[model samples]
Target: MTSAGSAKKVVVLDYGFGNVRSAERALARAGADVEITRDYDTAMNADGLLVPGVGAFAACMEGLRAARGDWIVGRRLSGGRPVMGICVGMQILFAHGVEHGVASEGLDEWPGTVEPLKADIVPHMGWNTVEAPADSELFRGLDADERYYFVHSYAVHDWSLETANPAMRAPRVTWATHGAPFVAAVENGALWATQFHPEKSGDAGAHLLKNWIGTL
Candidate 1:
């Protein structure tokens, strides 16, 4: 465990998308020594890495590639380092994202497709509750009725990755619904992701961030 004087160092990847400044501030408040940068070495060396994303999946991927953020995430995960993704940052972790009928490739860290919500409303914005698993460290100590902020149209409606080896632990999946249920969060090994913006989710969000920071 790190000493109180040495807070966990976290990097909010500034890959030209998402609410970078807001994420940095939130992580700082969560007791992390936070830096917002696209520097490969700095990001790789951080105690935790947060990938924040906004806008379309294709555009986010484009920018991420330009900054080599994808490489950083892959390398970090290969070594069992902690990495987190928020909003579209979470979406792009999947294999593909189908937005407006255009299928774009994602990081492929997880096998899934991000498609538009089937709800009458296109973008499932605002606060909503999620069904997190009992063993979820991210949602630890949070109430079942606790809500988080979400602002997006596209999401992974189904989770298809099943653990091939019985001895290996399966990925913990969290679910939330609009017109239909979709993946709200995922904790798989070193990779963690949330479709909602914890930075925008008020006190519950703050608690969630603290939970993630604690894991770091």
Candidate 2:
């Protein structure tokens, strides 16, 4: 066990778009040494970085650039150190977004784009269930009925293609459509993300946050 003062430190990037307070509180409750900072150097030094975002893609991207730029966080995600993104923060991990008729580039940590949810509704609210990806470390303690909080009009349509044969497969990317489809997913490598607010989803959310911290 880690000594009290020797606990792992985590930095939550406050890029001015997401629910900063809720993330900080969640991290703290999960026993991370948390610091809410917009300073690039400070954010880069932590064991883990959590980016929680809300609002438009272009606006959030601008805030991250103005606050910490792209390279710093981008490099860390690429390095495979633990990095978590909630809601639109997760969406921005993809290659881009075509919201409001403007194609805004994402941080490119993941291979996908953020497109508006169509058919059912825009900005899916309340609690919705998510099935765990068959092979995922992020779903360690989460169950099938577990629901997370979501409030967004856009969702990810992954551009990464799946080949019939794992060894001979060249990935082809696809976009998520505006209709009834997958609600949430965890893909790529060590990175994990959600289109919902686990911080607002009671014990289920708490368990996810705790699971994420344990990974750190």
Candidate 3:
């Protein structure tokens, strides 16, 4: 953990697919010393690592692997280091993402499939509210009515990961609805993710980012 009064060092992994600059600005505003880089050493050494993504799931995964970001995330989680994903970044953490009738394998950190939302209107764009769990660290102190920015057509509609061990804490899953309910966010151990762009979500997003940074 960073010392009190010192900014946490956060790396926004630049693997050719995310809103890198936007995320950097937001994290900086949230009190972290942010760096935008794909350097393996720099990313692993940072107090917090954030993965941001936009566009197709397959393309993001391809870029991420080419940059060895998949290795970085897996390694970080092995040591219980903090890692967060935004937008399509969150999508690729699942087992598979089927976009445009093609299935691309994901990081599989969480078991599930990211499929197109069964919505009347595709790309559930604009602001929406989420049903955050009471014990969620990411949503801590935020109002229940607070909304976040979302711009995606694909989402994980079901969560299949369950704690096999009775003593282990279950993952905290947050939900939002378009034409139907889909995962909005998830918090499991050192790994955290959100389907919505907290960076673009305004004050509520800032608060959520601050909450994650505080834990770093």
Which candidate number maximizes TM-score? 3
Clashing pairs for predicted structure model 2, backbone only: 118-178, 123-152, 123-153, 157-176, 159-173, 159-174, 160-173, 161-172
Write model 1 residue lDDT over 118-170, tens digit each, in one string: 89997898999999999999999999999999999989999998799999889
State TM-scores per candidate: 0.97, 0.85, 0.98
Sorted on TM-score, best first, the list reads: 3, 1, 2
* lDDT of all predictions: 0.94, 0.72, 0.96
Give the per-residue lDDT of model 2 (tens digit) for 34-136: 8988777777777778888998988989888888647667777767666778888878877888888789998876657777776566667777776565445
Name the regions of candidate 2 deviating beyond 4 angstroms. 1-5, 159-178
Top-lDDT candidate index: 3
Rank candidates by lDDT, best first: 3, 1, 2
Report the error of model 2 at residue 171, Å.
12
Higher lDDT: candidate 1 or 3? 3
lDDT of 3 by residue, 44-151 (tens): 999999999999999999999999999999999999999999999999999999988999999999999999998999889999999999999999999999999999
The candidate, 2 or 3, that scores higher on lDDT is 3
Candidate 3 TM-score to native:
0.98
Kindly report which residue stretches of model 1 are placed more than 4 angstroms away from their true locations once superposed. 1-5
